[model samples]
Target: MPLSVDRLKTLLQDDIKDLTKLSEILNKERTALKERSNTAIQTLASEKSTCIKSIEYRAKEKAKMFVDAGYQIKKGEFEKAIAEIQDPSLQALWRKVNIGLRFCQDQNTINGKVVSHSLKRVNKLMDIVRGQHNKPNLYGSSGKENSFGGLNSIAKA
Candidate 1:
């Protein structure tokens, strides 16, 4: 026997409720992922800035030494000063600066890709929920016959 209108309406209501719940869950997951991505980006930016400041400080120190030594500083002198700085701490700092720069670049690229992917997925899932919510009356004379057209209309609206 064919289902009554009330029964069909009840079933559709249940489906809508389930879909709404799923959409909420997906939204929450997307928000959490975005927060994590933002944190990672911020940490990388902080590390990169610290490394840049160290490099600038090292350059300034070398410049000061050249000026104080009563010698017209040449490019080679600057290079030699950097090379001759024998403090293990400074050497490690320089290495860390370079490593941080490379790491920041890599991390930014990866984070951008991940964010793009996440946004796309979120948009797709949202489209699905919206289509379900805006669906036309299937049995109505004015209802759209094509389900795909209904989805397109929802996307446009």
Candidate 2:
């Protein structure tokens, strides 16, 4: 036997309520995921800035040493400067700093890519949920066309 209109309405109302609840849950999850992605991005940016500053400071220090050694060279005291300074330690420090900077840069890139990709996925899921909620099958047939008709009737006056 066919269901009564009241019974069908009740069933549709219940389905709509369930779908609304599910959409709300999905939105909450999407928000939380976006927050996590933002935090990861901020962390990556902070780490990158710190690494750049450290590299810049070390480079400045190395440049100063080079300048001082160059002055000694200009004064014909290159042998004394060479004798007094340990070039190997300076070279090793430069190499270590460069390697550290490269590692930090690589990590920043990786973390940023991961966060961006995750955010894109979250956005796509949010769009899907929104689209499902906005469909005529779920929300009934009262949409922009009805609003436009009302406006057109008013304009005919």
Candidate 3:
């Protein structure tokens, strides 16, 4: 039996709502990252996870709908299935969902980059504090390779 158009529309509408919430969460997460607010970031992460779960559930429901309708869904081909349905309204809803998902993905990517850069800086600072520089030891003005106890060593002394 083919999936009802009304049912598909509901799923798509739910997806749009979730995607919009996800996009907002991602933007807030970006701000949290910028402000280095761990509390806000953690809260947003939890909300994002919930939103993502809802989106994934709806996506699975959509795929199941297609399968029930005798359509094989391939990766990146959900839109194709929508096209095959021949329903203009469904197609439009799918487009909105697709665009919203893309926006969320881009925002997530940006957040990831911010996290990566921050981690790198933190690691570099830790290395400096530990005197664990990867650079080769250079000779000092006295012709001796510069060597000094790291902060950790001094603390242990």
Candidate 4:
């Protein structure tokens, strides 16, 4: 069965709503990471997962609609199909959803970087507390092992 234009619009609008929520969650997650709030991070992680699942489900439904309408799901295929409908409102909604998703993706990338840096710091601290003398082998511009300027271990530094 061919999917109606109304169904396409609904999916796009739903994606816009969920993507907006996901973007907010990602921003909160970045703040939580900076504040080192474990509880808030955990809560936001769950919320983010749920929001992502909903977005994926909607995307699959939209793809199914395209396939049923005899169009191959590819880049620009959705816009092409929407153009055929000739409804400016639906096209606007599609653009909004696309922009929202891209924003969310950028936010998520930033949050991941924050988490990675935090983990590296925590690991370094852990090595320090454990009294492990694992000096970071940083090379200077001269291609030589840079000394720690007379510091014996991480604890002394």
Give the winner by lDDT: 1 or 2: 1
**For residues 1-157, could you state the per-residue lDDT of candidate 4 as single tens digits?**
7767898888888898899899889989999999999999999999999999999999899899889989997888777888888788988998898889888888998999898888778987998899988776677899866545446575543
lDDT of each: 0.50, 0.45, 0.87, 0.87
Expressed as tens digits, the lDDT of each residue in 1-157 for candidate 3 is 8777899899999999999899999999999999999999999999999999999998888888888887777775666767778999888998898899999999999999999889877976998999976655557899865544343354553
User: Using alpha carbons, what is the TM-score of model 3?
Assistant: 0.82
True-vs-predicted CA distance for residue 47, candidate 3, Å: 0.3
What TM-score, computed on C-alpha atoms, does each candidate reach? 0.33, 0.39, 0.82, 0.82
Clash pairs, candidate 1, are none
**lDDT value for candidate 2?**
0.45
Put the candidates in TM-score order, highest first: 4, 3, 2, 1
Reference-based TM-score, model 4: 0.82
Task: Go through the candidates in order and give the C-alpha RMSD of each one to the true structure.
Answer: 26.6, 28.2, 9.2, 6.9
Question: After TM-score superposition, what is the CA distance of residue 1 in candidate 1 from its true location, in Å?
Answer: 96
Candidate 2 local lDDT, residue 113:
66
Q: Which parts of model 2 are misplaced by more than 4 Å?
A: 1-86, 132-157
